[model samples]
Target: MFTRFSPYWLWGLLSIFPIFWTYLVLASSNPSIVHILVHPSGEWAARLLIFTLMITPLSMFFKNSALVRWMRRNRRYFGVASFAYAAMHTVFYVADKGSLAQVLDELPRLYILTGWLAFAIFVPLAATSVDFAVRKMGRHWKALQRWVYVSAVLTLVHWASLNDWNSPLGAVVHFTPLVVLEGYRIRHHFAMRMKRTA
Candidate 1:
């Protein structure tokens, strides 16, 4: 199946998914589009970011070379998709506020500020994700991309502080697995460094 379809097609298909959902949500008479988009897009972004981080550890844990290869080949798509959904979520937020100026005014609030900072980190990461940027930066590219983990943590903080129980509970549910996977990766990397030094 992978041999038959091009990655460009995958990109286009994934790109259309959110737009289609947005249209349907707006067409409904119940909840507003802004309401529908905010939660779904944010959750989608969270899930994609989680999957992007999982690719390496899951493959290694299962001793699956095919999983590793496939995930490595497509990791960029997942990263980009996560950013897209995040942007979509933010756009709906601004729209719900009636104007960009209102959103800016609210930026003084902690939740809004945290969310802005999270996206600020994502901006440079997304900009430098291309092949050209990778080549141009060489070794530093890996260091720069490491910021994704930071952004993910900031995103969770932003969510956890947003309200009462529901948001924090959601954060715990979504964040626990990511924390565990990253912990494993850190331990493995440290052991490898120790072995090399010894």
Candidate 2:
């Protein structure tokens, strides 16, 4: 019964995010909503991306089979949410600029280009997210999805370079959990390598 309803639970949880954030954006004042739309949308994407990355290491650490299963199952949902918010962020950017051409003109800027590159990586990852794609692509699908790590790095760069960390935005602080998790992963890799060498 739990298995049957887990997807429903996931859908409901996911639905809350879009509905709440969209409502906040819509209710916000006009001039402030410009920043409101872009920031919340982009930050949510980053947060979800980090959570997706954490599923593997976190599941490994906890040693809880049910937790592991849930994380693995919901990972794709988190990934899709990440991409959706990224799309919204891009839309907000273009909308704020008031013209597609105006936004295009800024593509040459380093920060803008970095964000674009991250979004580009998201496209294929989101496209091939289905189970059929997994079966069809087999080994290659995993390789393609590894690009997600590259996107994460690019996203961090874009956020850091574009926003102030010490300000109310707390941009850099938002990635704290991800940094800690990744640090744990790095240490574990070295520990394994040392054991192998011994």
Candidate 3:
């Protein structure tokens, strides 16, 4: 059955798997569903965003790997899916808060503030993730997408600042590989430039 559909279709299906799973969990009507889903949904959003960002450095390092090339082509799918999961996370958070006033009360907290800022950045990036926007924005599209780096930093802070900075291992572990690969990418580029100039 999987053989009949193209890889793009398969990837698209994979991208939405978390949403499907969340729906299944919600349908079960667990009383704590909002609380249960909140962390995982945010984690999925972060993971997908990491995957989306990893493509460029991985492609640079791999150079000729078909899998990396495929990931590069489908990077936007991961990005948009990241936004979807993030929206879900935000919804679940609001539901858990039970009132707008309660939610607003926590907005002054560092973690909450950073998370909202990251989500704010994601809004425009996700909105323009279409072919039409790509064509219309042309060179500017990439510049706008660069804001994802800022979002990533805010996400890291948001995750780390939870519980008064008592627990940050999960967020640190998840982001470590992306940081390493990006560092390598920068170093490699600098070395190449030096070689060219020499």
Candidate 4:
């Protein structure tokens, strides 16, 4: 079944879930609409970002795995989707804040500042997630994309510090796998370099 259709088509199909979720959120008559939208959108953004980052290490570890191969091909989609959800999350937050002065007033808070920093990093990365940018930037493209690591760390800090660091378990749980995989990727890279030198 998977072989019959292009990956883009599969991605399109998968995209319906987020589209539907957004529709549901927007259509709801809930009084706390901003509150309702913020957390879920942020979670989706983080999940997709993690999935995008996971592909490289998974590909390295499971060179022959079809799933990893598929993920590699669709990695850009995951990244763009993450940015889209992050955009939504930011929009909802701004709407919740109600005014520029109010928003600026909260900018000094650690959680808010980190969240904005992560979103700021995401903008350039998302803008350059294209064939033209890849060709034009050449080696520099990868260097720019590497900033996602910094964005991920900021995102972790943002999530964990919410409510004065009162409920960090969710953020810790979500990010643990990413931390472990990245650690392994670094170790594997050093090990390979050592082998080459040996």
TM-scores for all candidates: the values are 0.88, 0.84, 0.90, 0.93
Model 2 Cα displacement at 123 (Å)?
0.4
Q: After superposition, which runs of candidate 2 have C-alpha atoms over 4 Å from their true positions?
A: 1-5, 20-35, 163-169, 193-198
Task: Give per-residue CA lDDT, model 3, range 3-99, as digits (tens).
Answer: 3446678567766756675676669677887787788889988998988898999998788787777777778988988898899899889988999
- lDDT at 135, model 4: 100
lDDT of 1 by residue, 1-198 (tens): 554557888788778868786777668676576766677777778788888988877776877576466767899988988898898888878777887788888888776787888888988998988999999999999999999988888788777778633458887888898789879988999999999999
Q: Considering every candidate listed, which one attains the maximal lDDT?
A: 4
lDDT of 1 at 82: 88
For model 1 the TM-score comes to 0.88
For residue 27, what is the lDDT in candidate 1?
A: 80
lDDT (CA) for every model shown?
0.82, 0.82, 0.89, 0.89
- Candidate 3 has its poorest 10 consecutive residues by lDDT at 1-10
TM-score leaderboard ranking: 4, 3, 1, 2
- Cα distance off (Å), candidate 4, residue 9: 3.3
Give the alpha carbon lDDT tens digit for every residue of 1-198 in model 2: 334556777777867867776777688766767666787788888888988998888876877677677778778988988898898888778778988898889887767888999999999999999999999999999999999999998888788777433342455677778888889988999999999999
TM-score of 4: 0.93
At residue 50, give the lDDT of candidate 2.
86
Predictions ranked by lDDT, top down? Answer: 4, 3, 2, 1
Q: What's each prediction's clash count?
A: 0, 0, 0, 0
- By TM-score, the best candidate is 4
Backbone clashes in candidate 2 total 0
